[model samples]
Target: MRELPYDRLKAYEGQPVATAGAGKDLVNEPMIRHWCEAMGDANPAYRGPDAIAPPTMLQAWTMGGLSGHTDRSGAYDELFGLLDGAGYTSVVATDCEQEYPRPLRPGDRITFDAVIESVSERKTTKLGTGHFITTRMEVRADGEPAGTHRFRILKYAPAARMTKAPERTAAAGETEAAEETEAAERSKAPGQPEARRPRPVINRDNAGFWAGVETHRLLIQVCGGCGTPRFPWLPGCRGCGSPEWHTVEATGAGTVYSYVVMHHPPFPAFDPPYAVALIELAEGVRMVSNVIGVPYDKVRIGMPVQLEFLRVDGEWELPVFRAGGGVAG
Candidate 1:
């Protein structure tokens, strides 16, 4: 990401950011329907009769819509406004990836809780200063999780978002006055350290998994009641709703289920043009990790992989997998 001046980063801090407001029944229906059609996903589940919402619809709808739980009037727009107030003028939606647990239909009231996943200042570029920001939003209906939204925003601008005077527009006020200071602080304060991002907090659901990682072994939860496996250390089989479960050592061998080649430097921690894969392990469990020791072109469906460990920011160890054929960088 190209960075903006500190003045730009300072522009919008302390502004009130909100994502509130009940919207009319998906005025974006046509756009979503068109997208599905263009993608050739003519399944009845998302067509005329079934006409169910496409799994990705949540991206376009709740992006700035009525779904996610925020105090802002528009989710996407509100996020931009808040960023602008902080002085990040060149705001771009770097990418958005989503996982669907269930389908969203018409007439469902959507709600979500968004968390700042991470933030980083980048090395200066010829274009300008850069900052990589990531946010994770979990959507729910009633209380059950419906999906997770991973959003990456890159800002490149000449001016910062927040400052002491905040664009001294003299009519007895400033941009700071037009916007609520409370909004900019919602995600981050201008120039604040990046540690504020919400991360995977350890608890009963996933304690053992991390323990095994500390011992250089990978563990997955096996539901004794329903015979299902899970990750992020869940309490029970998401399949049968059984809470009884045990741990199993991963054989560390698996095949790729789905993947993508990330070209953009959306997250500062991760390098560009890396292969990110969801591998199905020998235990019939799928885990998300970066494919190390292999070139992006060589990654394909059903490629073989083994387990490796990467030390992420937290004291906990992150489990990364390596494909069997090639050695990683």
Candidate 2:
């Protein structure tokens, strides 16, 4: 039997990645304020004199910024070196999972310990063949367990791009007719695989929002206790500690409160250089969605937009904003 090239990577499991690590900054108001501003999250819970950090900011406090942690062990680097030597030179962060046991407050100090949790067997993906490396970091605030962060990354060689078919020269009329026929036939062909955008994670908490999308309506969740509105559909209200909420259909009018242009690590389902906007609805709640009806460069803060549904593929529809005062659908 032939041995697998990645079989040796299994030995790296359960190794120490970092220990006795300390965060560069303590939990403070300035960082929390910056994060809130960037995310367009005006939740009052994150501001003021008694403010606590957002639960999702658990990993931010522990990050060493551009100058990485000095306490990181060499085992992690050695593992990467081995993979690089084997031709898997490219790296991409796949995803991260975080669990917060306690709310981090201002003046709380942060410390952490991390270990290489598990290494997956070599797997082939659209990006190429590579092994998944998972690291689990245990975070503490003021010497008490506060949270855990699990981060995963893929190191793989880039896949060769598909070659385009050569163009044929002929009379314009015949070429047009032939091309139209070919496209029609291709669309009707059986067992043809099509690239699709990744489906949004639809769980109980946000299922109603997706349901609204299917009907071409945008619904915002309103807290029954405080009359405050929220987007991205959470199960409970962040204010007043209320789990009771109701849905309200938005007026479909909004402004581009903020936006970012994506232009790297292309995905098959999305073109690069597209604008993703943070839209502040007329209801005064902000939601993130793609901006259409204008070039990526033309999207700007305070630009007025109208709501519409984007049919990305056969089975999925997404709520998007169309800029330049187009009628709302």
Candidate 3:
């Protein structure tokens, strides 16, 4: 019997993918401050004297970045070459898991090593058929065990493009055919049902925001400490590191600060080529939402919009902005 492709991939497991690698820079407060600012993290533990790096930033210290690492072994390249030869060339990160044994602080020198942890059997997914490859890296800070990071990726051939069926036509003499064509047209009408949009993620931090949507109101979070308003509600204020906040109803006015048109790799609920805009509200806070009441191509930066509640399906309600002075929520 011929050996399967999965069997060949299994041979690469438990092999060293990289060894004796060292971080390009030491753990420093400057990089930590930049990361916290970008992530909107205002926790006091990450700032001031006696600060520590965020636990989730473990992998960041050991990355080779754009310069690429010279310590990487040929086994990693050979594994990818095999997959490419088998016509599975596309790749996407699935997820990652990490564990911290000790806190990483400033002035700590970092080093790491990685190995091929596993190769899974062939499986079919919405993206296509592919194998999952997992790698585990052990990280150390100043020669002490600091953390472990496990990353998984999928290498697959992309699925075929989706297409719609041809529209049916009626013939002059065929009465039954004409009736069937009419029914088909009715089924394709705009009033017919559609796949529901993905539901919003509601946690304690953002529950108030969704509750406001249910009540047909737009709410912005205002920090009690600094009086700064913020959107996409955070648990704490970024400006003054304050967790105290209150909600204020918006005036339903905004402008497009930035926008993008999505057109590739269509999903079940979203039609491609639609405009998603970064809207700056009248209250000086920004949020991302879809722009309606205009064609996708007509959406532009600096376009004025009014807030409204959009019911995409039977149960879910979302906040959207309408261009051209459309109806308010």
Who wins the lDDT comparison? 3
TM-score of structure candidate 1: 0.48
> How many pairs collide in each candidate, listed in order?
49, 0, 0
Span of 10 residues, lowest total lDDT, candidate 3? 180-189
Full-model lDDT, candidate 3: 0.80
Q: Which residue pairs does candidate 3 place in steric collision?
A: none
Candidate 2, residues 134-247, lDDT tens digits: the string is 999999999999999999999887654333224333232232223322321222223434435667888999988889889988899999999999887888776666899999
**Taking the tens digit of each residue's C-alpha lDDT, what string does model 3 give over 1-329?**
12236778999999998887899999999999999988777667788789999888899999889998999999989998888878788888988999999999999999999999999998777666888999999999999999999999998776543443354443323333234223222323244444335567789999999999999999999999999898889888867878999999998888898999999756445556668898888888889998776667888888888887766554756787777542222
Task: Give model 1 RMSD, 1 decimal.
Answer: 16.2
Task: Give residue 50's error in model 1 in angstroms.
Answer: 19
TM-scores of the models, in the order given: 0.48, 0.79, 0.72
lDDT of 2 at 71: 92
**What ranking emerges by lDDT with the best candidate at the front?**
3, 2, 1
lDDT of 2 at 209: 87
Q: Which stretches of candidate 1 lie over 4 Å from their true place?
A: 1-86, 90-200, 311-316, 325-329
Taken over the whole model, the C-alpha lDDT of each candidate is: 0.59, 0.79, 0.80
